[model samples]
Target: MRNTPLIEAFKENEQDLIRFLIVRLKSAFAAQDLAQELYLRVCGLDESFAVRNGRAYLFRMASNLAIDHLRREARQAELRDELQTFFGDEAEVATPEEALISRNELERLERAMAELPPLSRRIFYLSRFEQKSQREIAALVGLSPTAVFKHLRRVIDYLAAVRDT
Candidate 1:
């Protein structure tokens, strides 16, 4: 690095870096915020200016922090979108509020089903929802009654996955 003052280095690189951040972040305000955060970080370091790639380092830190922020925001947006999409998927006269609750319960059941193990899923589908007996499930799956009971026990473990915790 040259004898350039850190504040000057910050000023010189700020616009280009903010533009880079804006391209990825899709907002002028967010780019400006991240760029300022980068400048502050560089100012806060205790080490002397001896970097081989100062610009790269500043951009790398900003990108990582920005990505973390975006990921958090995206996850929140996904949850909100999920709520919106499922809020009115059933019959009218069911009431839109009732429809929303029904849809959410069905989604919860679907998530629980997805989390089930293969044998547990089979046993569950065969027994409860499909109205098959444990003996019939055992016969179809080629397991004994006792083993079927064991499989059912494991299947109940999936119920915990459905719970909110």
Candidate 2:
């Protein structure tokens, strides 16, 4: 095992690093992941590189990672809010005819979903409304991930055909 000064220091303060990250991120799991990332980063540094203070360097790296994670989370939250506002606000500006058409289309889609096999419908609901990953849906439904994908695909194709008609 190659032990650079930074890597050795990182190993020594690993638990403290995780605690610092957990304080910043408020997620022990995220803190663990960030700590792992920090270790990988330090390991990739040149062995010849000299650090006046290895612990400070590691803490700085961890802090930067936590800040980046928080910024990314904030950006995603903003995007979700934007999407909700865009979709929710659109209804207010819709003309009566457009609203009626949307309503009828929704009803048609519901009926088409109802016509689907129970498994397929359940898969579609889980994938879309519940925002579950295919692997997660597979686990819940006692099917392979590929089977879950196929079920979702069938539902999408059926809905597309209905929309086209």
Candidate 3:
């Protein structure tokens, strides 16, 4: 009934609440974050607010917060599906022949990459997959910036030739 005592109890039981939330939510990070949010929500309650059992009330609040998180995630997944459907061609499912062609193209690209010198292959991966800038690639590979540019250009040209064939 007393606000100060209730707030103290909430703080004292913080770990227990987080453990409960983790079990319900199945994510330690989310449980910790939501537990902090639950504390803030409880603290924001009116001082005159009364509950018969403060711990039970806190548990109920935590449960509601976890449920809300799950609901939000579900809604977001639904929205993603709807957007993909609306976008049509960009998200369209590929036909069997198209899939085969795409797979073959990827295999050809992989073979072309394997044909490059080891350093050139590493630089290409760092630039394309890891998305490092040319300057960063040069620093990592201990190459001059111009040399890195040349290596990348060579790789591109080689891939273009492979695609043409």
Candidate 4:
């Protein structure tokens, strides 16, 4: 099979393109993935589209992808900060017995979480921490809503059992 024009351009400029991406993305691995995505995007272009400078076109695509990555990372950081502000603080004053009970309860919850299956734990976090609906978690995790509900139910039951004992 013959190489497409896009592939040929990519082969010629792969190293320089990756170096440019790394400068913007700040991670070699992420730059490599972005470079591969750029290649796929360029491959989708019609052959009739005229490109006077293939290297310049590739650089522009890489730059745009890097910008998108930065914006997504910034949004995630902002969300994390907001979540901390909302849930980080509680009433500071407590009796010694109350504090001891809180600590023990926290330890039990941690152990309960640790005992969960990997997918079950992820589903719990997506539901509680991210506050996603069951339908949303199903779509994100590629499970049926029923399955998500079951996993969540399992988590609740486990935690309740931990609390009782």
Best by lDDT: 2
Which ranges in model 3 have alpha carbons more than 4 Å from their true place?
1-3, 88-165
Model 1: pairs clashing at backbone N, Cα or C within 3 Å: none
Instruction: Give the alpha-carbon lDDT of every model.
Output: 0.76, 0.90, 0.87, 0.87
Clashing pairs in 2: none
**Residue-level lDDT tens digits of model 2 in 1-165:** 588888889989999999999999999999999999988888888888888999998999999889878877876788789988888855467799999999999999989999999999999988876567799899999999999999999899999999777
Clashes of each: 0, 0, 0, 0
**Residue 65 in candidate 4, Cα distance off native in Å:** 0.6
Clashes of 2: 0
lDDT of 4 by residue, 1-165 (tens): 346666788899999999999999889999999999998887777776657788888899899889878766776898988977876766356789999999999998998899899999999998876667799899999999999999999999989998999
lDDT of 1: 0.76
Q: Give the range of the ten consecutive residues with the poorest summed lDDT in model 2.
A: 85-94
Candidate no. 2 TM-score: 0.53
In angstroms, how far off is 16's CA in candidate 2? 0.2
| Residue 47 lDDT, candidate 3, scale 0-100 | 86
Q: Summarize candidate 1's per-residue lDDT along 1-165 as a digit string, tens digits.
A: 333455566677888888888998999998888888877777776556556667777778878867866865776787778876876575247778989988997888788888777888898877765556678789999998788888887777657656553
Most TM-score-accurate candidate: 2
